[model samples]
Target: MKHLNIGLFGFGNVGRGLYDVLKRINSDNVTIKRICVRNIEKDRGIKAEFTDNPDDIFNDRDINLVVEVIDDAEAAYDIVKRALKSRIPVVSGNKKMLGHHILELIDLQEQYNTALLYDASACGSIPVIRNLEEYYDNDLLCSVKGILNGSSNFILSKIFNEKMGYKEALKLAQDLGFAESNPTLDIDGWDSLYKLIIITMHAFGVYVAPEQIFTYGISTMNDADIRFAEEKDRRIKLVAHVEKIDDRLIMCVIPQLISRNKYIYSVEDEFNGVVIKGLFYDKQFMFGRGAGGHPTGSAVLSDITACAYNYRYEYKKRNDSVLPRYTTEHTFRVYFRYKSAEQRNLLNFLKVREQYTSDEYNYIVGDVTIANLKAHQEELRTPDCFVAAYPFD
Candidate 1:
């Protein structure tokens, strides 16, 4: 049997969980050779060789596997790039790194004859990526969308269910380790956007630049927005979505109003759910714990074990003759809330569905192009404004 000596990065939640899980599995041939951390003196609750130097793992040719669970995207990219260049298989949970540098990383894998598996990056424990790559590879995926970020979802759930304020719910999510080290990533929709970019590769076999997609977070959402949702018999959720409209694909991550009858309406806390629509299979829903140590660790472990057989993503869709073109020509009916008329004037609404005004709150429900939203994303993210999909259907 070939021994799989692993070099691990970042001994935080996911890292520690991977360690505990590896120990539980009792894979005698699989052993952690060394752990790399920013601070080596921090007590990690296990007796293992730890180092701050990246070369410790890079120089040790005996280490055939690298597991990177670090929070830093640029740092993780460097580590992953080096490992692949050395012909080492890597199992990563860094969505930000993969979202930004996946094309280059995949190229590296092909060049060096190594594998990169990151099932833990999106929809933790859901196995969505593998299913997209294998099970749905041949199927015509019409759309893939749902609650992709658990931290943001947790905050939304708390606000709607417990009547907790957004800031309170967000702080609670951070305290429970559901939110990322930089809460801005989760609350501001960048985390979900990053994961969405990764999923688009597997789902559509096309690489879409993150900048092209408009993302609006829940940080600016106020009680008026929540009350509006409540009055309309809907719940607010930070949703990441992509879909095909003829030959074009539209994608975005933003706070959306979900009706009660939807599959994802009940998804709460640190849980994730995805709805996939295909031409043949129709609609499929997948639900699982989306964040935290143990659940994500289980996902990482699956990827690690798959390395035993040297499995890698085939990216079959990329090789497809015809691929869907990502476009911003799509228009969606959305509810925009703002304190001042000037803020409301920022968006060019194609059609007005409804309008409400008051001293405390003012909003407009109207049709707005994806391009218009992307153009005014900075203004939309201001403290006085919040936007959500207002699909009445």
Candidate 2:
């Protein structure tokens, strides 16, 4: 049997899970040679040589592969760049790093003749990234819409389960370990924004930053909003959407009231589901556990296994195509919500395409388009206003 030595970074929840899974598999073909962590004496209870120095892994000559489970962008970027420069293959589960630095990393991989694979960054165990790369070659992916964040989904579920408001539900989610110590990213929709960037890059060949797309959170959601949506036979979800419109790609992460008829509406707490509308195929839905130590670990292991096979075969490939630049100016029908009558008057000046009135709030569905939603973002940021857009059929 052939053996491969692996270096692990950050033995946190996902890292520990990787170690446990590897132990359960009991594979003689692979061994964790070393682990790079911040606090070596923190009692991780794992049987591996732990070090605070990343140079121990980066500078090591025998280590053939590096797996990064660390969630920091700058640190992980530096480590992975060094590993790639050293001609060692790398597998990362860090979406934030991959989201911003994929192009540069791909460039480095080509220059150094190494592989940098990230299968777990977007969807855990869904294989959405690889599936897009391999399976649907000739088909045009019309759009991708899904529940990408498990933390926000857990909060939404708690709101429904306990009949609590958004704040209370978020608190419950935090208490139950479903949320992080600082959940600003998850709650503010930036986490899903990272996933959206990865998906767009994979599916549409587009590279979008968090700043390029519109993002909203479920923080403004209330029990009344949930009940009203439910009464209307709709489900509330923090949906990450990317669609192609008139040769432009428009993406957003926002709280949406989706009809129960939609496949994404059925996806509940801590579970993720992605729907891809292909021109050649029927709407495809892939659903599974979005996040957890084990599920995410499984994804990272998948990447490692692929990297190992590549090393075994000595196969080298490069993605030379330039990432597509997207414009956020595409027009779509929007569902607008308002809290006060004052802000509602401002909509009359922009364009009054269509409107709906609910008990808790009013909706203005229109073909109005904003050139750069983020530049004039203050106009949409009023506490009284909430907006969601849908592609017009």
Candidate 3:
């Protein structure tokens, strides 16, 4: 086995967790040569070489691996690009970065003959990417749907099970390190959207840009929405779904009403659950802690270990002769709650199956196309509006 010298980026929670796990495992063949952080003097609480200069890691010929856990997507892209250009293997947990730049990065890796493994990028330690790359590469994959964000899931669990207010649950998650101080990415559903983009590439060999998918989060949810879900015997989960519909693929990330029979209905707290459906294999569920430091750090460690043996993702699905095309022409069953009839009219519902109005609440259950949702997504994010997608054929 070739000895590994790692250059780490971002000494935040996940980066620190990686450091601690490496120490605990005591892998004699691996060592962290340098850690790149924005603030070198921020008192990281452990002894290690730290640098504010990117070249400190890039210029060092001995640094054979780059593990990036940074929050800045652009900077992370630059670092990973430079490393792959230099023929160094990289393990990244930056889903936002990878989701945006994966097509180019894949080309670069092949051009320079290096590896970029990102099992840590999606669903923490569940190894979703690796499974899609290896296990389901030859299977007739029909759909992938799941809870992809643990911070949001944690908040939802608190709201549904503990009767906590959304803001209170969000604060608790942030205090426990499950969420960021400014959690627009998680709560507004961008985090899940980015993960879905990455999963789309692996599951169906297509690159769907983030903006193409319609995303609705739980930021606008309230007690009325919760009561409605309870009355229907359902739980609201932020679900990212990508399904191959004939020759085309349809994708979306939205707050969904999950019935009792679904795998993700009971996946509470910081845990994530993914249900992969294939033609022959049917549906397979993978569940684990989807956020925080240690679980993600373990995933990064697994990639680093694979690097020791010269393992890399083949991305076999991408090599298929006919790749699935992405489309937004499909429609979905939805439940929309708003403060006024004007807000309800904003969504171009194809047909209304149910409508309710009371002194305190007004909502409509109907069918709406993905295109209409994408066009009116910002309106749905308003304070008085909440929308949840219902399961429909």
Local distance difference test, per candidate? 0.91, 0.75, 0.90
Summarize candidate 1's per-residue lDDT along 157-231 as a digit string, tens digits. 888889887788888988887899999999899999989998999999988888889998998988788889999
Deviation in angstroms for 309 in model 3?
1.3
Candidate 1 wrong stretches, greater than 4 Å? none
2 or 3: which has the higher lDDT?
3
Q: What C-alpha RMSD separates each model from the true structure?
A: 1.1, 3.5, 1.3
Give the Cα error of residue 52 in candidate 2, in Å: 1.0
| Best-fitting candidate, scored by TM-score | 1
Error of 1 at 88 (Å): 0.5
C-alpha positional error of residue 58 in candidate 2 after TM-score superposition, expressed in Å? 1.6
Each prediction's TM-score versus the true structure: 0.98, 0.87, 0.97
Ten-residue stretch with the least lDDT total in model 3: 130-139
Candidate number that wins on lDDT, 1 or 2: 1
Backbone clash count, each prediction separately = 0, 0, 0
Q: For residues 1-393, what per-residue lDDT tens digits would candidate 3 score against the true structure?
A: 899999999888789889989999999999999999998879877889999999999999899899898888999999999999989899999999988899999999899999999988999989999888777853489999999999999999999999988889998888877785459899999999999999888887788888889988888888899999999999999999999988888999999999998889999999999999988889999999999889989989999999889998888888899887888999989999988878878889899999999888799999999888888988789878989998852
Q: Which candidate achieves the best lDDT against the true structure?
A: 1
Q: State candidate 3's TM-score.
A: 0.97
